[model samples]
Target: MTALLSRPGRVAAAFSPAHIGRAATLALHDELALAPKPGLVSFEDTGSHDDMDAHTFMRSLLALRSYFTHMAELGAAFAPFDALERSGIEAEARMLAATGGINTHRGAIFMLGLLCAAAGATQADGLALSADHWRAALQQHWGAALQARCARASVLSGGRAARQYGLRSASEEAALGLPVLFECAVPAWRAAQARGLSGQRLQLQVFFQIMAELDDCNIAHRGGLEGLAFARTEAQRFLMNGGATRTEALTDAREIHAAFVARRLSPGGCADTLSAVCLLHRLGALG
Candidate 1:
């Protein structure tokens, strides 16, 4: 709710690399703190996986604390795509070491890291910290590289599933400036705030919206195409039934969580997208 830099002010100094990096880290925390996230790990429970818990996420967060800030600094300098990619690769190595080889935030490391860089680049250009400016900076700086990257074969499970199912890979989403994050998730967050919603309820609504829209490779990798479809349908159904406004909303969400865990369907992409929403919120871009 506090914005150090917004459209009217455009305070470049306020959008420092450390500030952006801290925001990105806190955004990941915000995402991790959300409970009943439907097959994702949380403080109250590990929704699906036996391999990870909240402590693992905490270690990952600790490892990634400075990565985003560094990325932002690189972006402010107008560094090339290869530089950002190298930074990300190094950060991923730290994350893996921290989590003891568990992939706690691989998707977020790529997505949010880019956005953090884009935000810094936008600030360097004297642009407002609005979603549009950040996204444009991303496209202007690394759009072509991301597009080219999408064409390469990926050995990662999520990427392989995306390729096999003909779904849009994360690289494709990045090349196109993360349409779901900007077009869908950000708007949904604003709409929820406009509806007198706040706190976890607000986050839940936005999370469901992203889940309903994203072709989550994690879900596909675990549950295949059918699992992906099921997750989306369930998310849509949650939203249709009054979303977080329902009197029994938490109970309903928990039920959905149980179902997803039973099938091992974690909508990791949606979780990453929600973290992006949190980053924008922290940056004062949502207002």
Candidate 2:
């Protein structure tokens, strides 16, 4: 348990009331129209999931995926008595869906993160994985996890989940950074709080530092820009039970080749993705 608790993103202590209050406050905001904050996550309207060429689109997705898993593990660790944690987790899921798609392994990582964060796993309590490290792990291990989750969601939620996962394409991952992700992530977590006092922002305060530590989780597995194509081919070939073979991993190298072709739209995609990332970087649940 100590080792598990010590995961890079894990919190060393329990969250404070004030922190929780802040989380609740922001999470419940009425979708205020604020200027496009820039940081952390980066997306653009130009390319579809299929259009994400290496570098930014692919790398960001890779990072987001890992963060999701670290965060999910953190949430599952916290066995709570009320809905505050659970509700927040659900809200995180919504945010990920709107911001990050769950089609590819990286997107799945974000899903995992949202659920875990919602469960109330503060950096103080445990779940210690950096965003980068976590992303590396997910990029490395998420294939198996995605297959498993895809199958599970398919069976439980019906084919709707499976088809949606299929929509993830090769792009649409998040970029969780140290300075941006950790420095600003807590406020988003604080907003996630379901029920709490006014101005205390306990959830926000606690989440502020906690989400930042998640940076380790983000870059741990690093398959490189080339890995995205491989992952995509593997996804196409083997999924759930069929599974991706080593040869198929190579076969998918075409995705990278294709990435170069589509990169013309990077600038726009980068900007939009950044907009969402910035919001997430500063935004929290508190809902």
lDDT string for model 2 (150-241, tens) is 33333222133224333221122221222333334434333434334223233212222232222222211222233333333432332222
Q: What alpha-carbon RMSD in Å does predicted model 1 have with respect to the real structure?
A: 2.5
Those runs of model 1 whose alpha carbons end farther than 4 Å from true positions after fitting are: 1-11
Give per-residue lDDT, candidate 1, residue 99: 95
Please give the distance, in angstroms, between residue 234's alpha carbon in candidate 2 and its true position after superposition: 30
Q: Using TM-score as the measure, which candidate wins?
A: 1
How far is 218's C-alpha from truth in model 1 (Å)?
0.4
Worst 10 residues of 2 by lDDT: 30-39
lDDT of 1: 0.92
User: Scored by CA lDDT, what does every candidate get?
Assistant: 0.92, 0.31
